[model samples]
Target: METPASTATAETPRPVDRADRIRSIDVIRGVALLGILMMNIPYFGLPEGILGSLKFDHPGDANYLTHQVIEILFSGKMRALFSMLFGAGVILLTTRKEHSAGLSIADIYYRRILWMVLFGVIDAYVLLWTGDILYAYGLCGLFLFPFRKLAPRYLLLASLVCFGMLIFKGHLRFQDMRGKREAYLKVVALEKQKKKLTDKQKDDKKAWETVVKNGKPDQKKINDEIKNVRSGYPTVWAYYLPINTKIQSSVMYEVYFWDVIGMMFLGMALYKLGVFTGRLRRRGYLAMLLIGYGIGIPLGWWVHQETTLAHGDFGRYLDSHFLPPNRMTYDIRRVTMALGHVGLIMIIYKSGWLRWLTGALAAVGQMAFSNYVMQTLICTFIFFGYGLGNFGRLTYYQLFYVVAGVWAFQLVFSSLWLRFFYFGPLEWAWRSLTYWKRQPFRISQPDSETVVSSIQA
Candidate 1:
């Protein structure tokens, strides 16, 4: 009979072999992480509602134009790219350890995801960022386990089906918005004629009025919100905690779950097809870039124009909001653009034209968990009342200055830190928790070769 010590040793999970780490995946993940900051900085520095409304207090200015460009290009694409990479990562982790000595891959993966969820809670609530994705990713990851074994084509099909469901849901929302707008207009017409409203009509009118008020916020409310954010950390947390809770618990599932899951499925398909391995023909990547940009850029530009044209007319704006033209094509546009980015990056990586740049990005990707949390910490300190007290003070264009500084710091910091340590501090901790054992932190001379060759490979 085996001793208890021997039995416990047999059940310990093996670590992921670093030699098999794919550099291109890291490069893409690095790019996605950086791109995410471009979209997130607006929320960090300004009101969240600014992105949705066509009319801004600073309309037609450089800041306004900059916001438009970010919306058109980066808003959803980076997150989609990140989700896809995560899907690919699921397969990588599971299969790589399938035959290793340990618990079943599924058991280990579930534990990993559970830990991720815990981290996400800290990120979302304690960190006070409503846009946190880690929790959502962790929840959706549980759904990806069974789908991991599906063939590439089937996985791609399932992804498309998921997006189809979102589009269908969008259509329903559009219809509901149209109905509300019609009811609001009818109530307006009755009031103009000095007619009395029924009790139900009175309630409907009140609700619609509230919606319109929120959609086109008055200056006082905006200023008050800014004041609250700039008051101090305790005030900021008190204000945002409930809002973040609602977002994380409900809105995220209702609006974003399908989008993320679909992207993950598509990502897994792409990985299985060898797209991330740099095995695609040059022509294939060229076609992806051309076709993706050809459709996405023009459509995005048209949406921007329509949104601008609809400003200042509440009814028309409400109509535009209800039937956003982009709803029909949002997934196509974002997915294509994300693919275009992938193609562009892969070409750069394969050509070896900018090893230094790619190498730095890969390092950032390797330490993505640490860098992601660090970004939240740094941005919250800079903009929230607790630190710099600069919330809502900067223009959209000015916020990019902060973004650039953070990017530079992370890139340089990630590169230098990796030189001495095998894993990032957070990565090391996450690994230790996942495996229930401490992982090596310092890079020995032989381990340094492993890191170098992994990058060169």
Candidate 2:
């Protein structure tokens, strides 16, 4: 007869192996981070309206083309990828310390989230632009821990509920626009046919021209945008209120949480299926990737196009704001496109060609906590009065250059930092503060001393 402890050990799955750790997650995160720069670059350079306007008009055919390319390439995809990663992060952290008895895990987690919220509030007011996701993410983190033990099917159902509800909400809005009939059809026709913008349309062109032209933003633009951000822009304050922001950012932040958690479940399922660290046969994942991309990308593209149109609903939606709010098609498509991007990341991870790309990217991913805060710090200097003070001056195209510089800085710094230290600066500090004990800083290795562990290994 087997004892209960021995019986339990016999049935339990093994922990993830050191060599078996998944790089796909890191790779996907890296790609998402870079892709984020594509969208953020514009904000870093231009005015708020420019982000939306570029979709409809540009300075010329070239500018129009540039915006279109970015829309297809970056647009909604990166954010979705980040959201999925956020979901995955929850699973990772929960498991990291599941067996450790000496740690006050829940207390530590609560403090970590509190610190995150504190940093987010500080970042929003002092240094960076008010388009802060950190604050939203931190608030959401508080509720995520409880979901860690949910079964896969249940996880899938929750994700679908979160994602599907958003789409359903969007579908009604689109249906309403179709009922109005004239404006919706006209806008679609113009976009599909690629009609040249009339003079009036030219002035209304949307693109990030501000940040590119100005290295930092002019003080005036910063003050104006901040005011608009805080005011939530013409009833925008309603958008940011805890109630409305919760709903508005619900799909934006929490939806990603669901998707990511779903992916972690998917990843767990895949792990059970034998995929990570080369355990799964290439052909298996290859088929899944191909099939997934084949369907997901085009579908993503279509929905993305649809959501772009939802912005047009602003006036109509506002006109009837007093009534039960009208739903729009744009919302429906955002969910569809977001799903497509998730499929794309899954496929890319399966490709196996992403080793170098994933490795460097994982470097950034490993230090994501640090890089995230670093992004706030760096962008503040580039965009706020404390630094060059040129927030709303640069154009969209010019932002690419600044991003390149930052990318170079982050990549090199991340790689170098990892060599000398065990964690990114902030990450180390976060751990120390959370646990109230200083973790070891360096590993003493009797090495020919490789470049990998530079600080004190």
Candidate 3:
């Protein structure tokens, strides 16, 4: 957020030094960043496919132990927390510049996102996994451009609709899966009526049992699991019609894109309402937490559980069904959970004790651009093709080592770098590119008193 005075100082070439920067947002960003890795660490430690599995798919004593720890601790919740921060940041940065004299809000905002799209592409293609949210976020930011200036209530309504649409779409999928519920009933009924369970029942019993108590994800087992998803599950898109596929594409785009935008708008609205400004009453913040937590978590957990029950089972017979069954119930829950993420932020912010965690987190968030790339580079070195080639090899528990190692590295480096510069290196580059000027990279400043004396002489 370049202020009017800051813009003037830039034009006159007043050098920015250590004292000129704001610590609060940087702290906030750093906190958000640290939390992101807590979410990403498991992915780093495991094969990519294990992301949505009911059970850790790989085998071996070492890998099996790894999976359990990750599922229990670093699963979905932390990432959801990071997404809320991204939303808050969108508002924080944009609003800061909105009333400034130099960079037009529209100009800087669009250029910023355009640059992010390029960055996301490169990150996706060359650095790490192609499943990059940054690219989706870049695209989604465009949709948010027009609504930035609408009245808060209007923006609020728009965001709600987009989010609600996501929920509705999920509901439709859940309903579709319900028709297949009868199949499960038949299998269970048949097994029970026989007075002895068959092989199919045994397999299901296996799914319910959670194999981890007995095993770990070993390379040989991972190879087998990968083979299973790729070969064992036949590619029967027979039920996945072109229209439905298109619908899916659109739904996913909205799901990833709009959930983020909706949160940003909500944050922006909150900001306008003076929440982020620290003006909201304690009760108000408390109320938000209660509402979000009370409503969101249970709803989200229900969705997660239902979806797992409904469509988590992959069957040779389901070659007839292309769409996943838990769509709708789960979708509704994701939306509520996302709101719950906001509630979490408020709770954390209100806590004086959380300053330490938030400080570490903000350090990461401040260098998100750099840290995000760094995460990929380090993980690829640890797991991917170019380095150890350990993908599909490490245990789920071993993931913590990777995560802890990376967290230590990022924390030390981000703090060290901030000491010498106004922005993270990538953040500097982004701002420079967006402004289309060679912004100063150095923080050293000329003596103003000396210049004044010289002018008087």
Best by lDDT: 1
Q: Tens-digit lDDT track for model 3 on 1-457?
A: 8798777764542223333333344454454555566556655555544543423333345544444333332344445445545555566556652233466778878888999888876675445444456776677777676665666687667667766776676656544444344445556677678767677765655543343222333556556544432321122122113423443356546476666666666655655666544466667767766776676555554443444443334333234345543443433444444444444555566565566555555556667788878887787566544456565565455566777788888877775565445567888888888878766664454365433221111
- Cα lDDT for residue 304, candidate 1: 68
TM-score, every prediction: 0.91, 0.67, 0.68
Error of 1 at 382 (Å): 0.8
Per-residue lDDT over 1-457 for candidate 1, one digit per residue giving the tens place of the 0 to 100 score: 9998776556554334565679899899999998899988878888765645523446788766886788788879999999999999998888873232655788778988888988999988888887899999999898999999999999999999999988998888777767878898899899999999999888888877786778775777678778888887788888889888898877877777898899999999999998887889877887787887887888888876765655555568666564657687889889988988888888888888799889889888888899999999999999988889888888778899999999999988888787667778988888778777777787666466765643443
Q: Please give the CA lDDT of all the candidate structures.
A: 0.82, 0.55, 0.55
Worst 10 residues of 3 by lDDT: 231-240
Comparing 1 and 3 on TM-score, the stronger one: 1
lDDT per residue as tens, model 2, 1-457 = 8998866544442233223445556555666776677776676556664555544444355545567566654565566656656666666666663323355557767777788777666555444444565666677677767876776566556655655555565556545534444343444567679986565444323221221234333567655665444332233233234533453356555344443343444433333334333454556556645554465456545544444444444434434333222223332333444444545555555565555555667667667767876776787567654466565566566667788888888776766665656566776776667666675555345253534423111
Report the candidate with higher lDDT, 1 versus 2.
Answer: 1
Clashes of each: 0, 32, 23
lDDT, residue 26, candidate 2:
59
Identify the runs in model 2 with alpha carbons over 4 angstroms from their true place: 1-22, 97-100, 171-280, 300-355, 443-450, 453-457
Q: Which ten residues in a row have the lowest lDDT in candidate 1?
A: 49-58
